[model samples]
Target: MDFYELVKQRQSTRAFDTERMVDREIIARILEAGRLSPSACNAQPWHFIVVDEPDLKNKVADATSARLLGMNHFTKQAPVHIIVVEEKVNFSSGIGGLVKDKHFAFLDIGIATAHICLAAESEGLGSCILGWFKESKVKELLNIPKNKRVVLDIIIGYAAQPLREKRRKSSEEVISFNTYQ
Candidate 1:
C-alpha cells in the first residue's frame, strides 16, 4: 500500500490472534524503520527490547493490566511486545533541548515508534502502542536500568478484531495557513 493508505489503515489494534507467531525478519524490518527515523541533532536516543518469548510476553502483559479501568486486557493475546527505552541524547541534541526547553528525547522516540507501527502495517501485521502500564514493574521484569525510561510498550500480531471507522478532526478544523488559527 501507498504511504497515505498505510497511514489510513494503521490503527491501535487491541485484539490479536494468540496462536500466530511473528517472524523475526519482519520485526527486524520494523526496528530498522525506527532506526532510520530522524532525531534532534541525530541523537537517536532510543532502545527497543523485543519480547517474543511466551513467558516474558506474559510478564510484560501483567505489567500492563489494570483492574479498575480494564485497559490493556487484550495484550496477553499479542505474540510480540517491543519495549521502547529512552537513552541519553547526544550533546548537540541536549543543547538544543536546553535552549528550546523541550524534551527532545520523547519527541524522537515518538517519531521512531511511528515508523515502527507504519512498518508493521506494511508487513501485514497489527500493532498497538500501549502507554498505560506499570512502568516500574515493567522495568523490573525486563531488567532495565534505573536511569532508562520506558517510553512505550508496543504489541504486535495478527489482528483478531476487524477495522473500525476512524474519527478525526478534519483539515479545516485542525490546520491553519501561515499562522495559528
Candidate 2:
C-alpha cells in the first residue's frame, strides 16, 4: 500500500487473536524501522524490549489498568508487546554535541516508535501505542536501569476484528497560516 493509504489504514487495535503469534522476521523488520529513525546528533538512545511470553503479557496488562482504551485489553489479547525505552545521557558533555536541547531524546524516540508502527501496518499487522503504565513499576518488572526511561509501549498482533473508523480533525481546523491564533 502507498504511504498515505497506510497512514489512513493504521488504527489502534484493541482486540487481537490471542492464538496467533507474530513471526520473528516481521518483528525484526519492525525493529529495524525503529532503529533506522533519525536522532538528534545520532544519539540513538533507545532500547526495545519485545515481549511474547504469555505470563509477561498478563503482568503488563495488570500494570496498564490505570489507562483505558475501550474493550481492547492489551495484556490479555496481544501476542507481542514492544516496550520502547530511552537511555538518558548528557548530550551536552558528549563529543559532536550539537544536541544541547534536553528534550530531543524523547522526540527522537517518538519518531522511532512511529516508524515501527508504520512498518507493522505495512506488514499486515495491527498495533496500538500504549503509554499508560506506571513507569516505576514497569521499570522494576523489566529490570530497566535508572539511566533509562520507558518512553512507550506498543502491542502488535493479528486483529480479532476489522479496524475501527478513525476520528480526526481536519487540517483546516488544526493548521495555522503563519502564527498561533
Per TM-score, the best of the predicted structures is 1
Predicted candidate 1 versus true structure: per-residue lDDT over 1-181, tens digit per residue: 8999999999999989887999999999999999999999999999999999999899999999886789899999999999999999999999999999999999999999999999999999999999988999999999999888999998999998888899999899999999999
List runs of model 2 lying over 4 Å from the truth: 67-72, 89-102, 179-181
Number of backbone-clashing residue pairs for each candidate, in the order shown: 0, 0
- The digit string of per-residue lDDT tens for model 2 on 1-181 reads 8999999999888788888899989999999999999887777878999987778867876676654554334556888889989775445424434445357777788899999999999999998898877788778888889667888889999988787788889887899988975
Of candidate 2, the 10-residue stretch with the lowest lDDT total is 92-101
Q: What are the lDDT scores of the predictions, listed in order?
A: 0.94, 0.82
RMSD of 2: 3.0
